[model samples]
Target: MNTTRTVRLGLPILLLAATAGLVAAPAAEARSLPTYTCGYTLDQPQFDSVRGRECTASAGAPLIGHHWITFQMRNSGSGETWVCNSVEAALVPYYLDNKIDPDYADFERAYGRGADASVCHRLLD
Candidate 1:
């Protein structure tokens, strides 16, 4: 009789423990953010490619649908200050509030204006 009762209690405890572990696994092993790059342009008739899309983690703005981003170009000309803007279509959403990876933040902070769409992580609500 005692053995039967003990087994009932033990099974429930084991099941509860298993459930807790299962719930925590995904949160612990969540996927990390991939790298992204944005483009930079110069003030010229033919917009020359000064730099390739560089990685960044600037996830401040809330992106709805496909977000469009315009980054002002920093002039590299000889003492000539000029600003040029380039717009990226369908910018990817890259940050979440609940969890942030300490090792690295999302691309919004890292790449600033030099990030492109290749490395965007869709956040879970």
Candidate 2:
């Protein structure tokens, strides 16, 4: 051990193993769920009849208190079956009133094709 005292004790053990590998390196993933852009507002004369459908979901930001906003619907002749509704993200343009769906004349002809949205984050307590 003569090379300058082994290079000052291996340079402090190589800087403490490079700071313990950057503090165990592992942390980057926290976004429960939020990001939507649905569509479905067949302007049947703007809104006077024809089932007066409406479902233009949207959620780009603002939704961090347990999060909430899931508007889904699909009943074009009962394609299996799917109908959901949950708005709370400050409620921004979330309308899904397919004429109250009494099958509303098959959802007023083509009023139900696809209009999904999502932004939910409430993991326990």
Candidate 3:
């Protein structure tokens, strides 16, 4: 009779311990932000080549996007400074606050007037 009672109580404790482990796994991963890679390539009338690769931790909602946005330019002759070239390999994308960013257009326009993306160190939202 005592053994039966002990088993009943131990079973619930075992189940509770298993549940806690499962929940903690995701929480630990969430605490550590995942890193992502972003590529940089530039093309213009004078120069065209793959600049380099960059690393970011953005969650893909606010700033991280397909096109790498330019925050600063390198002062190229034709304004295609290829700023992203000199920027740090690891950078944080600009947050848009879920609204239209005038600087987004400015960055695109300053690089080379490229319809898709410009040369810089940032990514699209």
Candidate 4:
């Protein structure tokens, strides 16, 4: 199928699964939450494994662009952190509309793993 057609059809399903994953998500409750960060790198040409994009930004910065998105849920108390999958889903359209190029391949790839918690970052206050 064409890229646009594929995106039109697949995006809704991906969003639905991603949303379902969030409803059961645990609430953020702790005295101090660790700060987490995440990101992914494309498999470079002639490369073995993916590199860490280590996506970081100012707090409250909108993730609206064509590029990989990562969520790092860090523990402000102990410096521990993890990823939050729901936030990742909520950020997809932004990435697709702003970050992914006309090729649409990257958008598709991000959508493929859209439900993986490994890609989310939840910031605790």
Candidate 5:
């Protein structure tokens, strides 16, 4: 075949091969992390009136012995909020009815007024 015709035909085949390789390339897999939940009970009626109070966290794999985590509490009302941390886990709860971006973190909801806890942590695996 003439040089011009060969070049034109080869260019399309080259482009097609490149496109096919990209389409067939494996996608990057997403990493899955462990999740932990902290439970809370409203014992005081004065603090129980607030609606939508929750406690949550994204816990990481323990390093040396401690798992680096962020705890948050949000209360929309004028209620009370508390953080309870123990050797096993960390818990934040809305008492009077009282809430990051982390691969693994927790949250707590609040009531009455608005309350927010902002905390960030960097974890090295």
Candidate 6:
């Protein structure tokens, strides 16, 4: 006598899938707050990094381009070299606005004297 045997594993598979759905999802990780510190470099790469130290909405301040320039003669007609600040904000012709640049009274006026004064003057050059 020839006979055919049928295996009915579909119910077991369905139960396994249903159990998987009942599992709780892994907890989501919290996003980290921005790292704040006094100016770490004479040349702050981005204007937002400067504002980051101030704890203000980035949009509230104008985004500007900048670079550091070491004044060979700052005070005493200066030292070997000293005084580095992101002074190029005044020189940047255009950015997102693509219009006239903000007429900063001076380099220190670009961000505000407080931030400009925080520039890291000494570093392992």
Best TM-score among the predictions, by candidate number: 5
* lDDT (10s digit) by residue, model 4, range 1-125: 69999999999999999999999899888533222233543322242223222444345533433334444443233444454332332233434556545455455445433222343433343
**Cα lDDT listed for each candidate:** 0.37, 0.36, 0.38, 0.42, 0.36, 0.33
Model 6 lDDT per residue over 1-125, tens place: 12222224566677788888777566689743211122222333353222221212122222244545422112212122224444333212233354365444343333432233234343233
The alpha-carbon deviation from the true structure for residue 3 of candidate 1, after best TM-score superposition, in angstroms, is 0.6
Model 6 worst lDDT window (10 residues) = 71-80
Residue 57 of model 4, lDDT score: 38
* 1 or 4, greater by TM-score: 1
87-122, model 3: which lDDT tens digit per residue? 222233433355475575434423422222233333
What is candidate 2's lDDT per residue for 12-109, written digit by digit as tens?
A: 99999999999989979864333223333221333221111233223443321223444333223322222223332322233345346455433332
lDDT of 1: 0.37
For model 2, give the 10-residue run with minimal summed lDDT. Answer: 43-52
Q: Clashes per prediction?
A: 18, 0, 3, 23, 35, 1
Model 4, stretches more than 4 Å misplaced? 1-36, 39-58, 66-90, 95-104, 108-125
TM-score of 3: 0.27
User: Tens digits of per-residue lDDT for model 1 on 1-125?
Assistant: 99999999899999999999998775556533222233442333344322223323233422222234433222223322222233232233434353455333245432444322322222222
Q: lDDT of model 1 at residue 52?
A: 24
TM-score, per-candidate, Cα-based: 0.28, 0.26, 0.27, 0.21, 0.34, 0.21
Ranking by lDDT: 4, 3, 1, 2, 5, 6
- Where model 5 places Cα greater than 4 Å from the true spot, the runs are 39-125
Model 3 stretches with alpha carbons more than 4 Å out:
26-125
Q: All predictions: root-mean-square deviation over Cα?
A: 17.0, 12.7, 13.0, 23.1, 14.0, 14.5
Which is the winner by TM-score between candidate 2 and candidate 4? 2
lDDT of 2: 0.36
